[model samples]
Target: MSFEDKESPIEVDVQSLDEPIDIKAEKKLIHKFDYRLVPFFCVSYFFSSLDRSNIGNAKVAGMATDLNMTDAQFSNIASVLYATYIPFMVPGVWFMRRFARPKYYLGTMIIAWSLVTIFTIFVKSYGAMIVVRLLIGLCEGSYLSCMSVIATDYYFPHELARRSAYYFVASSFSGSFGGLIATGITAIKSGKLESWKYLYLIEGLLSLAAGIWVFIFFPDSPHVLTVTETEKKIQADRDRRKAVYMGDTKFSKPELWSALDWRLAVSIVIQFCQDICLYGFSTFLPVILKSGLGFNKMEAQYLTVPIYFLAGGLYLVQAEISDRLRKRGPVLMFGTSIAIIGYIILLAVKSSAVKYFACYLICFTLYLGTGLNEIWLASNTAPAFKRGTSISLNLSLGNVAGAVSPQVYRDAPDYTLGHAFTLGCLVVCLFAVALQSWGYKQKNKLHQEILESGVDNRTKSRKHGDDDPSFKFLT
Candidate 1:
């Protein structure tokens, strides 16, 4: 059942085949130092996140009263943005794969969304606010999916989880930063514009600046970078090695359709349920602090700062552990289970101090699990065009729950129904994680069986060539 016993189609010299791949050497020589890539990705994500969640800050700074809207109406505006996002998710990735580089696509989307965000400052009515938000969602949908695809292009499967974690952590900081920025802007009482309007304008301008920087510096893929010839060859070697290991290099219609099998379908469903908990908590945290804990605006915003920073920090830690272990299922399950417990406490506890502490626990648990989700999906997918498309599909479909989560807040200044709904969804997330873990274990067992038999087994009869081994699960 060992890897040594497998009869692979790859015509490597027996000696070389027996030697383990030197991952460290590859990382040092091939990847070289690309400081710009991570910064560009992180900064772009920070702004994207800031723009998306500024509405939460706006709500507390008098946006609701100015626009003559109720809490439910504000929630509806949030819901409408997500509703527009669902249809654009898959198509945006498809477009990225076809017409443009991912960096360009992602940067352009950022600029567009930021512009839409800035336009929100001019809106005078609920209808106008809804229109601006819808545009913002439509423009912003491409950034996360495309950024994930770009990360996989730069890092190997084993390296993906930590990088994914970093990206999510950046996003979490953006959420935290948005609140802090709102607090600072709200403190300026003598400004010509209202605090809420200034929040949108300032965040939007920051996004515009970040978008420009990304467009200038970010490389499309490893192959397109301005590295030395030796580095280029190493990068190509790494890409080919990944393709050979994964068993495919291009997207095929049949393979794409097959990848959406029952297992992936269930993962998407689990993601949907998880997002309800995630978006609900993140989008409404400030509101919860103000109303539930009876904190003033500045106090509530400052309290939100540590919660998001801790959440981002925990995500990065979890990602590093997951990548080091080269396992996805266990990490994901553990993170989700932690989130489930946190939510349960939030539902059952009565003390305000206990509730605030539980909020931190909830943020940590949800975000840590989220980082694992990105890593798991990105690692399992085949490389090349299919990887981008498939990851996008998973994220986009999973996020459809965003459209439904805000509705759970209606008929509630208490938001009790929303919390109960999230708890139920977390239970479903637990089941889904268990199912995915079982599937991964089953696949690994079958591949081990084939290795033991010394037969060139193709479980689903995928293409085998003279330079490739049968695909193996990372676990």
Candidate 2:
């Protein structure tokens, strides 16, 4: 029985020292953490998401025509961002894991991407667009990974879903907010810059502000912020119970390999399935509405506002349900089912207004795939490096869809292939969820039996983090 820290391995009976923790004060401290951390991260993510997706709005605002680009070249612009993004995630998470303070790293990356967003104003050709998007992708690749690390470090398993949802809700809000901003930008008559250029400039500045705020204010650890000895003890106890090696920067080979568990493997497949639709539908929705659905450009720009808001609102409800039930499978399946119906209507129906209605149905699965799947993975995985690797691998592999998505939707006007492809992905995701749910339940039951039989001392020693009999996976 060992808590695998390279610097100093620990073995302790957690129940023996649990009597001194004050439940009420612990609650107060957790509440304080929630307010101080969640809001700032949410706002930061809002800008990150806005910068990431606003290219869609810019495309409809005439970026392609202004750059003299063909449809194929423009589709490449949508995808080239992931060229660097996918490769950088694992290293980024490794950096965060080894660093004592990840806030500075995270903040600096945000600022870097924000600057790239501002630089999009100078993109006068297809190659320039690709360069800017590539730079942005490099800078933003690890943001969500860093945030996932921070969340796992600070919160309990049960709390991860709701907190993860908060960041994603901000992500969801960014789409709507950016749409509103783009709509307003279209109102300006100034010849100095195109409406698309203005979208980049304004959102970049906003994101820069958030980056600075996080750099200046985000805490390195709960211990650094807690004032009282009782609060500090509570933090220590919390970490002990979580089996996290607080402040330890050493990486373990075992934990790294443990990250390749079957659960993570299955989760990655599900992530790939969902992200195909998430990246495809989200980045292309504006174009889909304008080019395929026959809406005017301005109409396409603003219509995304309400649809994204619908996504955010529904995610909040789903997050609440997930936290309450302590289950990820049901909510995920439900979202996919509804989105399946949405894609059906989009493909089967001929009416423009009815197709518009189908977009709302598709929005139901938005956060479930990206945010909720992240929560499931983060909550289930354990030990700092292991969790970090699991998350990074899931994201890096899953987001290859960012590149694939643009190609699928190239058919335009009808986009029958794109709609059918995404629908098939949803069906795959449905079965994956069932398989993962069954796996978690079986593992939980096995752990329970091991704990009851007292055959292994790992529970008392808290060995192997989440693999210990005492630790239960969040299904």
Candidate models: Cα lDDT each: 0.72, 0.81
True-structure RMSD, every candidate: 4.8, 3.7
Top of the candidates by TM-score: 2
- Kindly report which residue pairs in candidate 1 clash with one another: none
Shift in Å, residue 253, candidate 2 = 1.6
lDDT of 2 by residue, 216-294 (tens): 8888766666788888888777766654433323577866777787888889889988988888888888888998899
Candidate 2 ranges beyond 4 A from true positions? 1-17, 244-249, 456-463
| Number of clashes found in candidate 1 | 0
* Candidate 1 off by > 4 Å: 1-25, 29-34, 245-251, 455-460, 463-469
Model 2 Cα shift for residue 260 (angstroms): 1.4
Candidate 1 per-residue lDDT, tens place, 1-475, comes to 0000011112223244334545575566534434647778778878877787777788888899899998889988988887677778777766776677666778788889888888888899999999988898899876787777667666766777776676678889988898888788868788778889999988888889888877777776666663776566656565555545444445567656656666668768777887887788888888888887678988777788888998898888877888778777777777777777777777788777888888876765566665577557666655354455667788888888777888886644557888888889888888887888788667667656766787755656454321123455554
**Cα deviation of 59, candidate 2, in Å:** 0.8
